[model samples]
Target: MSLRLRLNLLVAALNLGFLGALTWLLIDNHRNSIQEEIEAAHRVTVQMLGSAAQTSPVFGPAPVVMVNFLQSLGRVRANDIRLYTADGVLRYSSPPSAYKAGRTAPDWFGGLMRSTVEATVIGLPGARIEIVPDASRAVLDAWDSMTAIFLLGLGFVAMLHVALLLFLRRLLRPTEADARRLVATTQELAENREVMRLIEAGIEQERKRLARELHDELGQSVTAIRLIATSISRSSEAPGVTQGAGKVNEIAAGLYDSVHRIVRELRPAVLEQPDLAAALADLGREWRIRNPDIDLSMVLEGDLGDLGEELTLAVFRCVQEALTNVLKHAGATRVRLAVAQREDRLEAIIEDDGQGEPNALAGSGHGLVGMRERVATLGGSLETGMRPEGGFRVSIVLPLAGDSQ
Candidate 1:
């Protein structure tokens, strides 16, 4: 459900609960009041009639005097009086109450509010006086009062609910200005991402160009120099000349090796083939060779070779930058790199086994930031932190399905 609907439902539920509780409390109070009122009225009526029954024999025959007395007495408030002869003949009956005379409470409501006062009977020489409790009027009054209160409460709750819903709707509704600003911000973010993608693509193109120039121009020149030095060393008869030629040839070979290494770094062969596993393997081998003090371990899983060029390059560069940071900041002895392609996503983790700095990523260096940008461009995320086991860790995840090139 929508948040607005859920909130509205919550408010409605609270209102209903409050109404239910109030109703229950009122019912309990009214029930008690009716019971007490009816009981007190019945008690008084019984006592009054019982006293009159004892004195009736002094006036005349018990039945005749009581009948005359009841006819004069008229309808009692909450009792029905009747005089019956000893032969079971009904001599006199109390008149129906004129107060709410024709009306009665419903059976269910009357049952709920009715009191349990018993009928009173007085015996005399020839007749009996029966005073039965009558609570219909009292019960009807309670029902009327409760119904009025309930209706009032219901109307108030409905108005409150409507008012609250209106207030919430206004509070949650977004303004036109806010909507415009949100749209503008979203467009700006999209443009920024596009700009970053273009920048990265341009950088890669330049690197390729530089690698080609070094390989084609500088590489040939260095080869020519080495060939000339080798020729001079073989042809010269002077011992000094041979020694100088040999030295020149040795330096040229070293220079050539350095140039090739730089070209490889600029435009790795793995990028052309887009094999991340092979690229990482070559990188680890070279890293171990150069930084022999720090042992580098690499683990590749799944089909790393088929990750598109953009994703492969992004992962490789992130891992490369992370290792460089480890070497520069962490005084580590061992580094572990793991890359796995699991279904629709690629994950890479790089960790070092040296004293870790918790705030390494927050330092005044752009390495981590650059790596993050690179990964983000490929619809990926980068996380860097100090490992719990006394090292720094860098983790990256990239989505393979439907990712932008």
Candidate 2:
């Protein structure tokens, strides 16, 4: 069993044991109390008979008075009673079906009342003595009835506690299952993040290699081709030869332009400057120039100082992804970008007045997923939702400089 189950069982067992002990004690105490009441009743009955025998002699040895006394005692106390005469003969009894007036009392009942035997003795004229008791079989029967009732009550409580334990176990089982699933999910996410970081590092290394080849080997080859074309144009005098030389020159120029575009796309020149805001502004200006139909706005507020390089790169990349998504998906005529300092944190909000699709914003895709991961790396919060007016908004809040530690 699990530790929780073991502990629950241990607690339940302890509770049951305590309750069992308490039930036993209560039953024992109750039985003792009933026995004490029986003893007291027996004493009162004996005293009443003795007093009557001494006071009323007109009803001399009739046995009917003693019978009536025993019957009255039984009626008053809800237990049996009996009386005996001075000649070792039974004189009267109550609960008449089970007791008689002329028979010797049982040995077991005699033993139980041994201490009161002397108290019940009555001396007579013919050297005969009679013995009565403060208790009889009737008292023992009453005790048995009480014990049965006590046991029934204890059994009922035990069964109730058992049902309660089962109900408690069922209630907590689902929460335990959910906790186990959450632990597994967190572990898988951590492993995937490590793998993605390694792949990005490899991609960066390859890009650097291609940039070097384009600047060194490819640029030199293209320059040598241009020099040969120049020589051909200067030496050739025929119109057709000159026209062929010009076509070769135009092809070399086109190749150089293509190579330059490839290098620029592989890596941005502004990433080397180490100023995040400037780099982001330059990107926005370039996008605006490239896409003249869409109007873009930028707003910078508060102190944007004391930022470290790692955080700057992460913020820049997140903004770049957000803008790319906006241009591709948001069919908006206007876009607003805001970067500011709020308390000890930096805040960035990008909003576009486009045909809002909240489902698409939350969907797992390259741009949305990358932006979320980038912001999370800096221990920040990102909120993507639809604005009240009818636009899509991506808002981020990050800890500012000197506060990350």
Candidate 3:
């Protein structure tokens, strides 16, 4: 069964059971109380008659007194009572009579009145004869009234239970709807996360391709130009000729170095290695050599091991971008790059003691945008701001495999 239907039926059944039990108890109690009251009245009448028989003189001798007492007992307690003579003649009543004097009592009442009571008799050896009439119809009437009330109460209880079940079912509808909406939203977010990962992966591939073209094709051309200059120097022995060769060789060497540097910046060779810290350290060393006037420090605060390929690439790129920005914009003398596993998360911070402004390096270049996108894709966060001192700082945090959303 559906949950709502099952719950409704269960509630209804419990209520019905309780109502039935309560009704039975009430009806039984009412019937028993009325019967007890009637019995008590009959006992009082019997006792009063017996006492008058002992005291009254109009009753005459013992036999007459006994008969008078019996007659008076019949008169006082005969609400629907029946009587019979020694020869089984009908006698008296206390209410609307259903019997007449000429008629003998019915076969059932006559048989019951003729029966013997076996109580211990003080003078007689044999059991004494006694009479017992059927219970009063008034008792039957009271029982019927109680039964009617019980049935009515049962009907009311059933209706109330049904109403309660329906109301509870209606209340659950909104809660069920909210759960469904939450599930849908979570699924949508998961699907979007996958799409973003694919897009970022495509961008990485493109960057690698461009870097290869610059290194292989442009670097080769520069190498050929340098070799040609060396060959001219070897063959031309004249003073002016040698001077021209030396100058051409110097220019060619400079051009080759510059082209190689551009290629490396586009996509560093260290990224191809499996180790992330090594790649970052290589970038740091290169930056230090290129900017001899400024000081740079790189600290690996934890054991940098195999954090998956995508995450490693993203973190490396972020550090590369941050340092590049500092060198290009921040006129500070020192820069520090700190990478560590802080608590459960991997964190990287690039801080420089340079002229700092949060909006200073909001360049139109793809570098900063790519950095934000990469970190976001990993369920991470990146923030760039001015340090308390006169410097710039970039902080990035990415969760571990079990920790990431």
Top candidate when judged by lDDT against the true structure: 1
RMSD of each: 3.0, 12.4, 12.3
Which segments of model 2 are wrong by more than 4 Å? 1-196, 240-251, 302-306, 341-343, 362-364, 401-405
Ranking by TM-score: 1, 3, 2
Measured against the true structure, the TM-scores of the candidates, in listed sequence, are 0.88, 0.48, 0.54
Tens-digit lDDT string for candidate 2 (1-405): 985677677766876787678656754565465567656765675566567555444565435554554456553342344455655566555443344334444565345433322335433332222323334444455445545765676676667667766777777567866988988887776666656555655665677679778967887788788889989989989888788888888899889877776676455554465566776687788779877888899998775544665566666667777787788888988888998867878888889999877886557677777777666655577888889999889898888743331
State residue 283's C-alpha deviation in candidate 1, in Å: 1.5
What are the lDDT scores of the predictions, listed in order? 0.88, 0.66, 0.69
Candidate 1 per-residue C-alpha lDDT over 170-223 given as tens digits, one digit per residue, 9 for 90 to 100: 899999999999999978877888899889889999999999999999999999
Candidate 3, residues 1-405, lDDT tens digits: the string is 988888878887888788778866765565566556656655655455445534644546543445545555454432333333345444433334353333443444333323122211111011111333333443444445655787787788878887887798677677877989989988887777778889877877887898889778988887887788888888989888778988988998898888888877777755576467888888888899989988888889775667767778888889988888887888989999999966678999999999898684376777677788778778898888899977999999998763344
The regions of model 1 sitting more than 4 angstroms off are 1-6, 32-60, 68-74, 87-90, 95-112, 116-118
Question: Best candidate per TM-score, number?
Answer: 1
Q: Sort every candidate by lDDT, greatest first.
A: 1, 3, 2
The superposed Cα distance between candidate 1 and the true structure at residue 323, in angstroms, equals 1.9
